[model samples]
Target: MKELNIAVVGATGAVGQEILKVIEERKVPFKSLRMLASSRSAGKEITFMEKTYTVEETTLDAFKGVDVALFAGGPASRAFGRDVQAAGTVVIDNSSTFRLEEDVPLIIPEVNGEAAKNHKGLIASPNCSTTLLVGAINPLHQKAGVKRIIVSTYQAVSGAGAAGLTELEDQSRQILDHKPIHLDVFQHQIAFNLIPHIDVWQEEDYSKEETKVLHETHKILDAPDMAITVTAVRVPVMRSHAESVYVEFENPLSPDEAREILAAAPRVVLQDKPHDNIYPMPITATGSDDIYVGRIRKDLYNDHALNLWACFDQIRKGAATNTVQILELLLEKDWI
Candidate 1:
């Protein structure tokens, strides 16, 4: 492999740190690595791969000489994405700002990796829930021709970032002490609670998190007209995300057969053994790179329908690892 110049924007954030870890753990050959964050976080130093690097303030010029830039920032990602691409760097972004754009290809490499070759200097990683959802569903779609999907996500509070985690911990302590719970990171007290809302409401009263699943799945699978409905919820869990997915296929797909296919699917770890109470859980999937899938069973009403339960590290595979996978695809194809 050739050594390339790589940079990670928003290096101080959760997903950004994971991106660095993935690159290090995968032993990606890089001639140079740069870390950039906001001015507030600039000057911070991180030790990775036994080497220390300082985080610089992100700017248009920071992308200079970079071959591939992984972005794990917020809406600010759009600004840096344009700058990075203008500097001749390919940006693999982990934000919603670019996913719906016509020119940017929304990718889950395992499903539509070829789409990376179609990028106009930028590519998008899907939302966390969508990432895990597609990983477990794509194989079945290819085999049975999926017609409809109904999914409900149990997303961890960490999805809201560091503040969310702190808030949950504080709330738990407050509740245990019989004190008033605080609600800083969420609309309601997240400790020992579930918030059905994940993002701002949009058309038809569906949350942004819910709608992203519908659109991104279609684009990734090349099934623009497929029916996909999702409900995104924020739970008090610290890490990882879990989902209950119901899939209706065009062809007959039995539970046993679905289990067989999912077991052999790439990046999916099968744990379906209901009799022994073994199944995928957020706690078990906290640091996993693969999607843990189980609870396989046929829907009583439809012979072509099956229900699945899946869990995965929301920060790793969903954001950072997938972005790295895109870079790997570009590298393998010599696109970057």
Candidate 2:
């Protein structure tokens, strides 16, 4: 692949840092790198692959001569995604701002990579929760035809960004010392509790995060009519997200058949061995690149339904790694 010029927006944020790590680890060929952040973080120095680069404030002309821009989400993406694209850079955005736009493709390379070819200069990455849920099930959906989905997500605090992690650690220590708990990053005490609400409430009383899972899954898998319901819970874990998924397929799909199909699925690792106590968990998946799946079984009440567990490092595979993979796919196929 030819080396191209690359720019990373939100260079000082959580997902931005991981995107650098992934680019280094994956050896993405980039002739030049532009580090961009908000004005508050601008002028700070970051070192990557033995090279020190200065962070610049994102601007209309910031993406000049750049080949691809990997956005780390938040206000930056909403503010400048189209600007960067208009400047002739391919934008792989991690924000929800452009995801639902009719012309923009919501891509999860493992599930709908080919759809990325239809990009009109910008591509949106799915939410981390949606990424984990779809990563484990899209392969099954392909084999047995998913009719409906019921999912409960146990998301890590890091999903909220660095502030979320600090809140958990500080609050845990505060509770241990018997001090007044501080609530900042989250709505409640996230140290020892589970917040059933993630993002804000949307239509039908579902949190915005839960809504993303439902809608993004349909977009990525190209299953617009698929039935999906989600309950998103923010757990106290520092990293990685776990989900308990129940899928009802149009055709009969046994547990053994599901395992066989998932085991061979791309970017998936099957860890099903409950008798010996081996299954997918947040701790095991924290720094891993692959989504871990286990606890496969047939639903007790429904002959057409199957249950399973899935775990993934939301920061890695869900956000950073997936963004980089999209660029990699285009490079390998010479589509960029």
Candidate 3:
């Protein structure tokens, strides 16, 4: 691979820091790496891949001469996406701001690698939950034609950013210490409690996070008309997000067949042995790059529908690693 100048926008945040680690763990060849964050985080020193880099305040000119810009902040992506692209640098944004845009490709390299080539300048990474959702089943959808999907997501506090994780820790500690429980990072008590609401409430009552799941799945699967509904719940877990999905396909697929298909799918680890007590869990999924799927079985009543559980590291494939993968694709295609 040709060495290219890589820039990381929002390089100090949780996801941004994860991106830096991923780039190094994956051994991506880069001529130079630039870190950009908010002015508040500027001048902070971050060491990644055994090399220290200073975080610079993000500016329009920061992207000049950059080849691949990996955006880990929502506001920064919205603020600098066009600027970087204008500077002849391509951006792979891990933000929801452009996922639904008519032009930007919401890519999961394993599922939609070709879509990266069509990116005008910016490519969007789907929401963490959506990334894991689409990734777990895109292959199945292609073979069996997914008609309807109903999913309930157990998202981690980390999905809300580092502060969310800190809030979970603080609230849990407070509750244990018999101190007053505070609710700021989360709307309600997130320690030992579940918040069904994620993001703002939308038109009919579905949360924004759920709406993103509905829309993004349809788009990434190339089934814009596919009917998908999601109930997003914030679990007190630290990092990995888990989902229980029920999918109805046009063609009936057996549990054994589904398991076989998913086991061979890219970036998926199948551990479906209920009798042996083998299954995927957030605890095991944390810090791992692969999405784990298990409990593949045919619905008791509907032979056409399949029920499964999945878990993924929200910081890895869910956000950062996918962005880095897209950058690799761009470099390989000479699109950067």
Off by over 4 Å in 3: none
Q: Which lDDT tens digits does candidate 3 get at residues 214-322?
A: 8998788888899998999999999999999999999999999999899999899998888998999988888899989998989999999999999999988899999
Best by TM-score: 2
TM-score of candidate 1 versus the correct structure, residues matched by position: 0.97
Candidate 3: the clashing residue pairs are none
Q: Please give the distance, in angstroms, between residue 265's alpha carbon in candidate 2 and its true position after superposition.
A: 0.7
Show model 2 residue runs off by greater than 4 Å.
none
Off by over 4 Å in 1: none
Top candidate by lDDT: 2
Ranking by lDDT: 2, 3, 1
What is the per-residue lDDT of model 2 for residues 66-180, given as tens digits with 9 covering 90 to 100? 9999998889998999888887899999988999898899888878989988689999999999999999998898988999999999999989988888899999999999999
Task: Give one digit per residue, the lDDT tens place, for model 1 in 152-174.
Answer: 99999878876777898999999
Instruction: Give the Cα error of residue 183 in candidate 1, in Å.
Output: 2.0
| Count of clashing pairs, candidate 3 | 0
State residue 318's C-alpha deviation in candidate 3, in Å: 0.7
Overall lDDT per candidate, in order of appearance: 0.89, 0.92, 0.90
